[model samples]
Target: MKALYFTADKMMELRDIAVPVPKKGQYLIQVKVCGICGSDFEGYMGKTGRRTPPMIMGHEFAGVITEAPEGGKFKKGESVVVFPKPFCGTCEYCKKGLVNVCTSGICMGVLSADGAMCEYVAIDEKYLIPFSPEKLPYDIASMTEPLSVAYRAVYKISDEELQASDHIVVIGAGTIGLLVTAMLSYRKAKHIIVSDTQEFRLETAKKMGAHTVVNPASGDFEEAIKKATDGKKCDFAIEAVGISATAESSLDALKIGGTAIWIGNAQKIVSINMQKIVTTELSVRGSYVYDFDGFKKCVELLQNKVIDVSSMITDTYKLQDGVAAFKALENNTDGKMLKVMLEV
Candidate 1:
């Protein structure tokens, strides 16, 4: 088997490796498609510490069960999408179904667990969610994880707040942000506004049903959003960029008593105006990845065409070109690449 690994010296190297053998209660997955996430790019640029040196970095992926252990629930040739978050089922948090925050959990590709950036991976049977290859393509199935993040972010919003005419702003036009707006559109939310600094992403947002798209670099983001709403602030906001500026802008653009659902995890320390949060009686909540039910919901949403992400993929690469794929993400100065997939 061949795998793309981040070397200790800070570069993606494609190397030949032995195919993994599944342990007890595990299945050998022949990885079909793997999407390089934003975090993967961050790791490539040495921005994140989660992906240490010489690690396989990919969590958003789909594969087929090639070697299932005897008595396994699934069989060989069955396609599935992996719930890459490893958790201890006996933990208190997992027992309460808050597996997203599982204290004893490990996020594959992001943390210590090796991920699906290779041709084959041995995954525990518990984390595999079976799907039909005919109904959903491998690349789209691979999107289950990231789309689940967007689904959870919007799903966390109060149902009473999703008025058909309520003003909403998504403060980033990346994949999660775009999907957040897509989910908003799916639920018939009105007055959707997507803000970003890139022209291509804003265009993609517009296509995804953003009622308005504003380039934050063009002018004051909050002011532009306010102008769109006749000087009124958004009733809800989702901060998809984890920087201090975008995180603060979510509060800056919200109406009195509004809520902001934060979904990004790029930076550690971010400064916000506590005065604005208190004075406006606003609520800012941090949303984690989805629980088991939410993950299933995202899959159903994708299958039902409720959240069409067919246009989300910007490029594809063979495993042999994996290094070039990561390089494309790193050198994406034009902001043209939205999602890059590796065909393993």
Candidate 2:
């Protein structure tokens, strides 16, 4: 077996390693496609402390099962998408169905756990969701993890609030931001406003059903949001960029008592307008990764063509070209790259 290892900051190496053997209740999956996430990029750059060095770094992957426990719920030759986060069922958070935040859980590819940036991975049955490759390609199926993040972020707001709101804004046109826009489109949001510094991403947001796309690099972002909403601002704002400017802009683009869902966590801390939030009664909520049900829902949504993400995959590289893949994302100054996939 071969594996791509994140050896250090801005460094990756492909090395030959022994294949993993499946445990008693685990399934051995031969990875087909894996997508590099924003967090992975941060790890590559040594920006986030979540991922350490000398580990396989990939969680959004899809593969075919080659070995499984006898008479298990899934069998050999089954195509599956990994949930990536394996949680202890006995944990308090897991008992409450908040498995995403289970204290005893470990997210594959983050920290010390070796993930699927390799030829194979042995995943427990509880973390695998079987899917048909005919309905969803391996590359697209690998996006289930990020799509689930988008789903949970959009659905964080209640149905009543989402329907009652006339204006909604999504800050940042990255993968999560674009998917959030698509989910808003699926929910039939009245006016979808997407903001980003990159014009290419703004254009892509338009293609993803954004009613108004604003480039902060062009003009004032808050003014653009106000103009787009006819001076009412937005009823809801989803911040997908975890920087200080974008996080503040999400609050600035909202009307009184508007809700802001913080989905991106690139920055561990960002300054915000506390007085404005207090005076306007604004609500800011942090949305983390998705639970099992959310992941399953995203899988179904992708398989059913409810959310078309084929365009989101901007580039693909062979597993052996892992370093080039990371460099491509690192040097994506024009913002043309959206999601980069590695074919194993």
Candidate 3:
């Protein structure tokens, strides 16, 4: 089997490797497709230190079950999406259903895990998500990770304020931001405002159902929010850029009692206004990856065509062109590229 390996010097190389056998209670999945994530691009640029070199770094993926574990729930040759993380189910967070933040959790395709960049991976049968291949292609199913991440972001919103009557703001017009915008649009949110410095990404946000997009590089995003909302403030805000400035922008866009959720982790620190938060009675929270329940719901949403992901796949590259795929995603400075998939 062939696998793409990231080197210590930040280069990608295709190497021939022996196939991995499934461990106890695991299935051997023949990887069909894998998506290059923003984090993956970050790792390529040597920004995020999560993925060390000499690693197979691909988590967003789908595959066909080539060998099933003994007494597995699903059979061989079943088309499935792979959930990237494995949590210690006995932990407190896991018991409370917050698997994303479970302290002992470790994800595949990063650090010590080999990930799905190869032709085959040993996956726990419980993490396999089944969907009809006739209706959903390997390309779209491979996107379940990002879609699930978007779902988890929306899930972090205060339940009372996520309805159609509430105006919301999404800071960052990238993939996760656009997906969040789509979710809000599908749920009939009263208004959706997206902010970014890049105009092209803002344009994509508009097509994804953002009622308005603001280029903060030109002016204040708070003012843009006021204009777009007709002087009304947003009830909820999602910060997806993972920077201090955008997180602050999310806080500044919210109503007096509104909530803000941070999904991006770009910087180690950001300046915050404690006085404003206290006086305004604002609720600021951090949301990690999806829990199992939310992941399942998002998969069903995709399987049923509830969230249209057809437009998210901007480009696809063959596994042999894995290095090219990384370059394409990294050099997408105009923000024209959304999701790039590897046809394994």
Could you say which candidate leads in lDDT? Answer: 2
- Model 2 residue runs over 4 Å out of place are none
1-344: candidate 1 lDDT, tens digit per residue:
99999885348999899999878899999999999888888877877677887788899999999898888899999999999988888889999988999997888887557888999999998898998888888999998999999888997776776863379999999888988989898888878999998999999998888999888799888789789889878988999988899999899888889888899888888999999999889998899888988898887778767788988899999988999887778678877899899998
From the highest TM-score down, the ranking of the candidates is 2, 1, 3
lDDT of each: 0.88, 0.93, 0.85
Q: Pick the candidate with the highest TM-score.
A: 2
User: Across residues 233-317, which tens digit of lDDT does each residue of candidate 3 receive?
Assistant: 8888899988778888988998888788888876667887878789999988888878898888888888888888888788899
Overall local distance difference test of candidate 2: 0.93
Assess every candidate by TM-score: 0.97, 0.99, 0.95
Writing each residue's lDDT as its tens digit, candidate 2 over 218-302 gives 9888888889988999999999989899899999999999999999899999999999999999999999989899999999999
Q: What is the lDDT of residue 158 in candidate 1?
A: 65
**What is the lDDT for 189 in model 3?**
78
> Which parts of model 3 are misplaced by more than 4 Å?
none
Give per-residue lDDT, candidate 1, residue 185.
89
On the 0 to 100 scale, the lDDT of residue 23 in model 1 is 83
Q: Model 1, poorest ten-residue lDDT window?
A: 157-166
